[model samples]
Target: MDLKNKILQTPTGKKLLSEYQLNLLTKNNIETLLDFHDAENQKLNKLLAIKLESVLEIKKELDMLPWQSETFVETVNELDFGTGIEELDKFLDSIAQPFRRGRVWEVCGQTGVGKTQLMYTLALNFVWKHKLQVLFIDTKQDFSTKRIQDMLLERKVDQETSEKAMADIHVVEVLTSEELIEVLKAFDQQMTDDVQAALKTKVVVVDSLAACFVDHRGREMRRTRDSLLTEVACRVRKLAVRGVAFVIGNISFSQDSGTF
Candidate 1:
């Protein structure tokens, strides 16, 4: 038999009409199905209502997704990360220039070159001065609350104020490439339009983006790594477009693999 007749003859199709209460008729076919939904025929209308109700319920679930109705802001809040040291602050200012939305900033340096320190200072500035929340992706597991508190104290801020500033910052530790990817995906899910705007969140700092690549090597390593990084960079750019700034930190050990 033909497909339509086969379905009509099947036990499942019978159950759809009897058990599921779907309105199926011999006259109802593909072209007429559209008319069923569009027209006011009682039986066809009932079937359309049943299907549309399920569709509306599915839409309700989709509305709860994290990245819903996010507005893409053209400009972002600019804050200065000025440590007392003139030289360091100048460097910070240079890198963070045009500190607006939709920008993925990569900070590269060698060991002990103050990459983490700079990121911590930026996070502190965002939380304390700009009144913004920061999602700090601590891939290196070296994010120190004590360090933040100490910096706040040095600025003559009281203990309660310092604690409150630290509270605005959320940290996640991801050691492996898989863990990093999973954490980023989870973070994307949890971050909603309302949450981002209400908390004034704009910064996503990934400390040492290269640390996740420790075990990522093989003949296909280059291709896989490139694909992975491209995916991450695309996500970061999208987040940036929605008024979030992504600061990705990386390290280098060789002359050939120096900072670009």
Candidate 2:
């Protein structure tokens, strides 16, 4: 493949660079990976420089792989996963940008409105259909293997498939916002590791993000809460870039005025 085609083949390159930026590279005579690597230290505009840095980071990761390793581009799926609901999937597909990997989805609703249930369904659907893994971060200590098993049985899934699906849905309990951040950071590292098990994790479902910050009530802890949330967002985005889809569950607090 030529330089342009090679760059476009990688997820990071296709995501980070725009048509104009690619043209700019052509104008600058940076035609190959070797050429770009040599120009790494050259002065560039701020926006392009920042985008190039991320692409370069992905290149570095690919370089670290063994010569016999599979192509880096094949490590992640380029297609979108459905919500396991026919109507909902159709509706999302009608949108200009339908839900897909490398994106964060928020499922927010009032308590007892089936937010967590929806998260469970998504995780189950992803694992069962794709034979991929899901990282279910349970913040409220409500993750139940039995619940998932029951769901599988309800669907008339065979015993062997049910067992395999359950095994693929890895659950981790996190109590506080700090703990959530640490877990996300750990998952981020796992994504870059050369482990096949880590690569199988395509979706991360965080059940009830609000539960982690339930104690951050009053003015004193507002800043702390916001900081933690920002950190969590950053970590989530990092993982999403590596082709992991994130489904974050949140509770909507109702007040006298309306639900917020």
Candidate 3:
């Protein structure tokens, strides 16, 4: 089976891949699966192993992976948010300079603000202008399909490129902080040296980090949230240094943080 679509086609398979397959494919180590004489022709199986061996050899040399991997979908590096889209380009520019290698961004703002919209804009910019990939980690479950469709429609994102970008934008949802941690770790394992060197992580948006603190107990929630951001910032930056730019969103606790 083609590894790219295999996990998605099977419920159990995706879970297994998320749970265990990550470590097996990391940079320093790789695990191989061999089939026992089932194709009715021993030579065919031998040929299969040889083909796989060749794949492994090339993959090892590159020290990265194709965009089909769990990590590759939206790991876009050179964010050319065009001077179009009204004056929003100015805003995006002032916020950060396409997140340098080893850098990640956290977009924090008030409720009903354009924070999420900004993410969508950046997504479009990365895909259309630079043709880089992306990985969108949605914590709020608010990554709306309708909104994405609307954005594409509004910006005239073409059918083919839109389809391709939609397919490449890897999305993972998590309800708890711990699960988010696991997801990022698994996502990080897919990065290769070549991909990282290109500043290719388009952006990783958490979409409201403050909401994660609301249901918890005490003021300590801030600490927990802070710690989580620290870890997330750390991992994404490592990939950023290799050419991945990251963007995470949060809600502000003070007027000093500003609404815009």
Candidate 4:
């Protein structure tokens, strides 16, 4: 008998297997009834393995509950990491909605108008004040450790604290929009897994998001760029919902009328 006939012979298979599954089995080259049986067994085995792994993970978390309660003291308020500038902070606060966690803030301006400088300042402030980690995604390769260090010292932050703050500002350089998407996806996975690094990372700074797509000029390239940007935004929003703040720097350009 054919695979369909054999499958329909069993009440369970007839009820369980959908037309799509039958097509998928044929696509996978499961021609014989024996092949179909083996494929079904493999799928069952994989499902069982996944359930077993989930149970093990739950057990591990239960075992660590006591230790976690003692070690992981949630001291800092995740929503309150502010810009270091007092005037700016005051203005933001006066609006009744300061830059809080679980949100994406864009700093947009013309080139050489201190957009990157502002991003660096925000990253520094986040690390220095909150004692939390900042993920600096530098697309233009403009990240300067010396600049960060000088800013810290100018603030009269001591040697130990300065070094620690800089250490917490993790900088990752990616040249292309595709690369940025990959980094964001990986960071999203890290956050989803509740890894130690992700737990500590309260802010993610993308310095100059425009630089990643500057070379994408043609229509096809522009479409690809837009798709990548959409994906990046989705991933960043997902991370924000997990209580991480995002500060993205973007460049503004003037049209024929000369207004940005």
Q: What is the C-alpha lDDT profile of model 2 across 131-245, one tens digit per residue?
A: 9999999999978888888998899978898889999999999999889988887876666675777788889999889888888866777555555665576567557767889
User: What lDDT tens digits, residue by residue, belong to model 1 across residues 114-233?
Assistant: 899888887888677667688899987878888987888899987788878888898888887767766655555456535553336667889988888766655556545554554465
For residue 50, model 1's alpha carbon misses the true position, in angstroms, by: 42
Question: Each model's TM-score?
Answer: 0.61, 0.69, 0.56, 0.68
Model 1: per-residue Cα lDDT at residue 23: 31
> TM-score of predicted model 2?
0.69
Off by over 4 Å in 1: 1-96, 196-199, 218-220, 256-260
Off by over 4 Å in 2: 1-77, 257-260
TM-score quality measure for candidate 1 = 0.61
Cα-lDDT of candidate 1: 0.60
How many clashes (backbone atoms < 3 Å, residues ≥3 apart in a chain or on different chains) does model 1 have?
1
lDDT tens digits by residue: candidate 3, 82-166? 4245466567678755334334577877677888888777766666665666677777877887777777788786898678767
Pairwise lDDT winner, candidates 1 and 3: 1
Best by TM-score: 2
lDDT of 4 by residue, 118-173 (tens): 88898888887778899999999978999998898898978898889889999999
C-alpha lDDT (0 to 100) for residue 34 of candidate 2:
42
Off by over 4 Å in 3: 1-102, 192-201, 215-217, 220-227, 254-260
| lDDT (C-alpha) at residue 19 in model 1 | 26
